[model samples]
Target: MKQQSSRTEEPHLSNVENPSRPVNSARNDVFPSSTPDNSSGESATKSSKSLWTNLKFVRLFMAYALATFGDWFDALAIQIMVAYRWGADPLIIALIPVCMAVPGILFGSVAGALADRLHKVRIMILCDGITIALTVGILFAPSPAWLLPLLALRAMMSVFHVPAQQALTRQIVAEEQLFQASSLNGFVNQCAKIAGPLLGAVVLAFFSPQICILINASARLLSGAVLWPLRRLVEKKEALVTDEHNEENQKEPETFFKQWQQGWKYLRHTHTVRNTIVFGCLGLMSILMVEYQFTTLFREIKPGNESMLGWLGSSVGAGAVFIILLLNRLPRLGYGWGLGGGYFLIGAGIAGLGWVGPDTSTAWIIMLGLCTGLGNGLFMVTMNYLLQKETSPDYVGRVFGIQNSLYSVVLVAAPLAGGAIIRSAGPSPTFQMIGLATLAIGLTGILFQRMLWSLNRRSTSSEKVGSAQQGVS
Candidate 1:
């Protein structure tokens, strides 16, 4: 079994034939020209790393953070609008996440491929523009029904926006600093989550939900404005043209099925990519289902569902913010344990929500909310760091696209399932079941860690032994 596993492994940096080459020689062929330097590389590498450290990365980080805030605010506004204004039937309420997920599954491959070929910033700007227009469309629409399709389209735009931004990060940041960049982004995302929901809820207190929607739209526009300045900092690489342009038509167009087939082929062949995608699919499904279901759970616990849902969600967000703040202090933690522990806690907390009194005091629910948030926040940061570090830049966008699509699928499915289960068993048992499932998944992650680590270690050791024997000969 060990030998079979060992044969499938790929080369990582610890397997050097001449360890001194990276230090002694001026030319380092390991990374492409886009990798940032650490003051040790040739002039370009040094310059690249220098750019990575400056205000550009900071600005881009803030831009995305603001955009994410807008996204979440819109989500809160929609839920409030549907529940309070439009009347909340389970199926109708479920349509929100479903709308978001459908486009992602349909458009992921095309969007990912485009991200690789086009300028990432330009693509992001385009998404922002379209989303802003959609927001305006929502503003003019006579009713909630008119807004659903627009929201769905906005979700599709998000699919492209995220991967493009992630790829752009790789273009500017140095390899060693990749983890730092990922952590920073993760922290910012959590901060946005913490602030957006709370702020949106506050806005809902005074203004009509429709006005809040307009503000969310405006925030997207502002986010695009912030990102505009980073266009120069992001160095553009000539795209790898996998398809020849048809001179007569001037379009390199492939059938949708054919494009999807190509994407599957790429994913199926790449082992680590395959694993990452699977992990993301499974993980995201659990996350989306649990949170969406919480809407009903909150309703059962407190008569006023919308307000309770927003407050509980905000509490979870607060827990996430706390986790992000602790990342710097907890650098010694391993990703495997950290992520596993997070999943476990989240599952356990949500399950415990059932045990909280029928009175549903703010104190106990708030505590559980914190646990749920912290666990999810930790898992997001660690898992993302692992995947980004493992995959090569060439396939990052496509792989992430697939992952995002799977995430959307899970998000869509979970709420429907949650609603069904809640209706059947009531909130207590439903919460318990979700909690158990989450804990089991976390346990599975923890149990599988040894296998993955063993494989990584064996590969490293084998390479060292090979180099030693070659040197002796």
Candidate 2:
């Protein structure tokens, strides 16, 4: 429940009296040195301008954009190659995403631990380098069997890459700039989603899938190079070394299993993090259900016109972009309301698709796409901003890693379930069911706002008590 106004403040460290407790140990401490100096009286415009002018942040942003573009580019190329070139069956093609998701579910906690132990910049650069190599292997693959495993390996690399990249953001920007930075990052990602496929489709027309793969490889290489110079910014913390004074640290250094347990424990105890993950997972499941059925829905409305699907997808991206542009001008809605209200809109938009009949115009479908996109955009930005604001820097990677794992689990199952619903109940009823379920989850957040508010209040109160005890000591 950390609001946008609190973004300028450092993470509130737990002030538990028992130094031996996991919460008070050094492994859980926020980096005091990295906290931004928000006391300056500069104008909001000036502060934003200064953040944009920072060369380091600009380079990081470019690296993120390149990496995302490559992902989407390869995604579209692979799908086309498998379907047309390899003449793969639908079930085989479906395995692609499943393979990609498996690594996150299996290795997410381990990758997060590595991010915590190693230099995050090095982790990012190494992942990108591996991606480049994987893309090359993908280009030369003779069959779907060879290609699928390579794609999964590349996805595994990303399990390490993504958490490192997100955790690194705290080091790269000031506290006040976190929301703007997340917004801009989300904007670039959305743009890549729209542009990469269009560009890939164009490339596929004139060249081979191998050439598209090569382009993706080149993008990965460029992304790694962009991140290489960020080595200086990555904090080099000592990894779980034994401390003589602190009883918790005096014991043997925490094993990987212990660290993983700590991560789960943190997530369970942190109310804001727990709620966000639960509600976010629900929203994601509903969104993916709609997305998986999109082609089927499109065929019913406009048979044999796949190109119109692209237009509708692009409309969604446009809606996201519009929200990003007006983020600063928007009212200061708290996290619960922002997330809940956004999901409500998303549910409404998805359900609206069920109403479109044979005579429904293409324009109406595009508008519905826009509605869903806007809702998703707002929900994503707000959720990311709140997670960063609430989490201690030391634990950010692990928290994000855990969230990624849970998301992967939901993603892997959602499409299969959606397919079943579509087959059994028809697409329209399936949409209505998913949308209503999502809407109900969102409504819980809105109706229980006072409960969420109390969680935040209690968090703040505990921090104050901890600070007072330290002062007295």
Candidate 3:
């Protein structure tokens, strides 16, 4: 007689009974009486209010926002210093980003596994401390060569910091509030993106790069201090259960390589995670292509008007901020609608750029940028929220680690590919090609929505069962 594998058996049983149990259980356990009460509309309002009112959430949110702001601020300062002060060549300047990205490709999965095994809050604080120390090193760096390695080391710290922070968000916030929390986080990031560089520019106008680096280091130090208290909160909540889970995890005695492979295995088997990752990759590639061509496109439309490019960039940021704020106010939309619709809009907007030429109005060009940005903002928030929702707590860090590696690869490749296409076929055709490709990815998501949903249902069911078995054992 042939014997069936446990993995194959688990999904079949999961599909047959309690398909929604994992999501439901997460909500019920984390937020007592979180579900709406029939008699009182005010109760739901209060529940939503509680998330903002919670001291732990407020503290973490502020720390994360400050850290992000400092990062962007420091990045611009480095570019200015490298370009003007150090007299770095274009190739040297380019290497800065490449240095940051290489670590993600090499160490992302390993860092994620470590995040899963270690205390998340401590990991975040440790990473922040390292970043602060590295930032201070930049002030003393004698040459561009020295700075590049320090920047790479700083980037490596982020490889650990990001997954740990994300995993910790799951632990601290209620499941029902995850969407809003993620949205707020995205909002803070975008705000930092817009403000940080401007502030850096202002500082550079009056001060040396070293002063800006010092300010950035102080921000990092503040971030660590703010997070220091979170350890007590997390310890109180998960000490007993997490200790048991850790002990069990250690008992199996798996190698680091094997643990890293587990994340890939989970990603390969989980349909929702796989599809979302694909969709995100495609969407990001298309956006990057359009952005890379934007300067050329602007020059074609309005010859020699360099400052207009900044306005165009601002328009995109404004659009993203607008959409994020809108999503925060409205009821949460379904993942299928948000993902599919967002991509469709992004595709249409990017394709519209193909139509712009000398005859196109400046207002029209800005509008296209706004449209693409809005779609991007929608896609980012929805995909992140869904990823958090579908991923089990144990697997969150690993899944996000995989996502980071994939995104880093895309970030490095897309620009090179886009530039090649522009050189070979001109920017207009390249835009059209990227746009159509993005649209096709979105349409595929919409067409296969049912299958993806089914896969998520089965995966969630199996996770619940596995957790139950572990509890019993």
Candidate 4:
């Protein structure tokens, strides 16, 4: 149980679910979305069916999910090998996220801008291919020191992959189905969370961590293959979009540095993107501050239970899947409620996890896991939808890049501080402290929601007023 918990860590980390860059540091599979203002006009009965009909998106999702399938194992293997096999300390465990985050700080914005300037599908494919080599490199990593650098490189590639994947998602899915598409992607990640760990646990019981790492590498290789057809589809689609625009409609090319600056500018001027980034980063920082320490608690919970980490993660995934089902049923769930409520539940779950000890029953721990999962489903979906909906398709890649960069900046410090806290105060107290902080951050989001809503109201009113004025003139 003294092992660090990677299940939560995996969401933001490169190998896990996806979103906001791995260190996903906060979200997973945010691969991007398209939008129509609302889905009200759509046939209610076939809400999800409409999305399934898009064979291209389905194919991309399956391949991305396949790549994501492998994500669960790499960190689990590394954490187990580091904390259990290598007998590393909390500080060593802290380095895992730090390495993952550094790439974001260094390359997140650059990668994002690159995603926009380059062919997105090609960017995604290339990154996926590069990751195969990096993931395999982990197998040969003899120690924590060696494995961390490999994880960082893998993360570096993901910074590029994420924005490209997201931008491509925007183009592939229709406007009205954006939310549905995002929800479905979240579902895929949840399923991976559930299945990846359970399968990994079974594998771990019989084999070495190296075996699991190889399994992850193979998944990526297959994922890259699945995307080959998709690359052609996306390229062809873009060509058609380009053809529709006459010469005058074509965009004048901007220098790469200019495009990168424009992304920063867009993030700064756009309230929605700015606000979401703030919440996403803080929530992520709050979670990472103590996420890696869960392994310490697990050791205390069940001696020699290597699979407890996976089970705990699986429980979270199960909770998320249940919530995802419910959210899909609702035609309209306000972003504010979704985000605010998510923070509260995740905080509550983390706090409850703090209270667990050797005497705590397994059922109660699983229940807490459920709480976090529920919150994750809510927060992650809303975050993705907000970005997809509010962002101009033009700046999607840069917006995510800037956001991931911020995530990396936080990732740099949160784990180190968390490790220090855990080393000093132990896991229980550290969890309790960070959990309350996250709770407060979640509560703060209520105000953010109000401001966001008011901004939308004004924006809408201004548009109507301008239209009326024009008519009168």
Candidate 5:
């Protein structure tokens, strides 16, 4: 007690006045203007602000949400219109996803680079405006052929918008509040998915697909207006640009091919970045196969088919909302466990779906829905959070571009593959295969967790050591 260390005495002196030194010095040490000290207790309160409360985060989320909300309505309306009017063949059905997939393959890398280079909020705003224009074009001149191209355009816009928005979200929120921001955004998206389809169906029931297109377009305009005020909140990072001292950082005027090559190089060098892309592709392919075929599969199940299918499908969204609500209270329960286990449960649920025969009860499917929804909700939110958290903020847009591109490819392939499998092997075997695949992926993820945790811990420790050295120096 008589021989106190400097560390032990520090806390007591932290509150004391030192008139010899600058009065603001203590304040400066605690909070830097550039990066807020997220370790403080107030971090939680600051991160909880909604778009109205925090216009900066609002702009980015709104950009993303509006685009997604509008596009989903358009796509669903188009699909229903095509199915009812032309009676889409398997090949035609296959073409839809392919059109959506093209932007990812063609423009994905460039979009990422642009995201790194440009103002993210502005890019998103421009994309939204373009999307609305495209919707208008589609409304006036509706054709089966235009559907794919328009979807592709939307995909391209998405390629740019997603990464920028994600990066923006991170910049606005503190590190401690990242998980909450991610979960909240994810919950809204899932809720939108549920709401969009129901709204589209109602619109279709009353008016034409063109009118639905108009409604979607209107949503975009409103989103753009909401975003206009958010320009004030965003703090643009200067990492993308070059200075006289750092000539290597100079944005070299290059050919399109060269720029594309740069994007590839950036991705190749980033270890964890590519892992997120590849995992998303493989995992989503399996999940999308189930999503695409579930409706048709449910119709063949039994008496509770209609009610159960609706409940089950909607339950996943509901589950996501539930998970979002729980995230604040249970931060210790890691998302990795939830994601891996969720995939396994989804697999089990789908496999269970195959067991529903003509005499079986539909109540089982509702339970299955709960299982699938709970797992899916957890997986989606966690995966998204991990992807953003691990990536360098400067490279977020490019990485997201690659990720979305890969995602689109899987989404395209999954439905086509599911359709083929159903036609060739029958629905039961197809469902069984999807379930087994999901279970295997989940098990593989579980096995890899220990290694991931070790790497994360080692990295964190090294970072702390580096920080201490910097402070000492």
Candidate 6:
């Protein structure tokens, strides 16, 4: 809704608010220095109209949406092949996620460091091209045993693809548009959740699961095609930032090993990155550990094994979509507050769920699902925006790579821990404890916000001092 600006051209460095702002310098990732919404309703409406019309952003976003859609179908297709075609037990079925997560755990940060050393647009296009071959190779996987390795290989490609995509988005979209653009992308993810599975179900009825694999392969092709133009558009931002950084240091690009090590070094110094990994990741972990308990809770309350999980899951998606829409209509909420608000809302929803009982009305339960979804939508949009805005383009790849690896770790471990706890201590206490811990993390955001404020002040002062030393002041 903040769309009323008149500029229609793709992003240029002149669009940056401060001409002398330090290139690739650390700033506030949690509390962005940008202003809040002051646009009139008419201006906001105009901005909305121009949002998707910006051709550079449109092309980049389209590539992402297609990849996401195809990825969903791939998940469905693999399950069908193993479960229905090969008669796999549930244990074998579970290995699919393990395969996907393993690549992220093993290679996520390394892939990100590699992305920074290459042209991000080329990285994306190359990865997609590889994905097409990998998806096709799945058709020939002689047995379920072979599927794991193939899937792991494909996921490794994607681990590289994600950071490149994130870096490319930053280089393509204007700074002011970062939050809105990310919000729109989040909508695409939520929509794909609803549409992808439905489309897979419909297609499977009419054709073999191989048909779905073929569609996924095609999606990867098209995603690459849409990105071809970005090779030029992204260079604009890279050239802008690299000129300053390159001039300050008169050496070849840091050796790959140094770049990789430097990424870890940056993570150590950057408290904002540390905060999210510690607090944000933990909050998400808490929910994942307790989330499946819903199925158990419902089973105890109802006579038949009929679960409201499908319906409740839909409610969560709907809630997420609703909040994303609402946020897009408003001007940028203060991003630092957005982080705090997102965590608080999510923790609140999870905590509330602990109190749900058999007597709770279906409507009330649906509302709680929506609540968590709202928090998730906000958290994701803010996290992506923060990474791009705060980190130098040189380092964002590694930052996101680090995040992906940590998230995958939680994805694999949290559920296993939850299952163990539920078997011993029971679901009720586990949910209550995890939910409360998440809520406490949310409250800690305020103190972290103040700490980040001081960090930003110190960073800004250091930049000025450095410029003076270089005779640029």
What lDDT is reached at residue 394 by model 5? Answer: 48
Instruction: Summarize candidate 4's per-residue lDDT along 106-146 as a digit string, tens digits.
Output: 99999988987888767878988999899888888887778
TM-score of each: 0.77, 0.85, 0.84, 0.79, 0.79, 0.84
Q: Which ten residues in a row have the lowest lDDT in candidate 3?
A: 1-10
Tens digit of lDDT per residue, candidate 1, span 1-473? 00000000001211111222221122111112343343444434334443334465666766776677787787788888788877768667667667877998887776776666567778888888898999888777666678679878888888888777766665545454555566666776776666777788899899888877888788888978977765544344412222232122224454544444445555654444465457555655565555656655666666654566656677777887688567645535554565567788788788888676556677777788888888876777666655554444444566567777666666667767776777888887877877888888777767775543222323222232223222322
What's the best-to-worst order under TM-score?
2, 6, 3, 5, 4, 1
Tens digits of per-residue lDDT for model 6 on 40-103? 3432333344557677677778888899889888778888999999998878777787788889
lDDT of 2 by residue, 295-348 (tens): 898787668677767877888889877876677455455676767867877787
Q: Identify the candidate with maximal TM-score.
A: 2
Model 5 residue 429 distance off true place after TM-score fit, in angstroms: 1.7
Model 2 residue 117 lDDT score: 60
State, as a TM-score between 0 and 1, how close model 2 is to the true structure: 0.85
Evaluated against the true structure, the overall lDDT of model 5 is: 0.60
* lDDT for each residue of candidate 5 in 1-473, tens digit (9 for 90 to 100): 00000000011111111212211111101111333344443544453443245545555566556756776687677777778866867677768778867787777767877776666667767877887887787777556677667767866776666666765654555544555667666666777778888889998998888777888898888777867765444454423222243233233454544444555555554444455456556666777776777767767765354676677777766766676577645735443465566677777777777666766665676777767767676676666665555554445566666776666667667777888788988787888888889877776666665443223332221232223222322
Which portions of model 3 show Cα errors greater than 4 Å?
1-20, 23-49, 235-258, 454-457, 461-473
Colliding residue pairs in candidate 3: none
CA lDDT, every prediction?
0.61, 0.69, 0.70, 0.68, 0.60, 0.69
Q: After TM-score superposition, what is the CA distance of residue 374 in candidate 1 from its true location, in Å?
A: 1.5
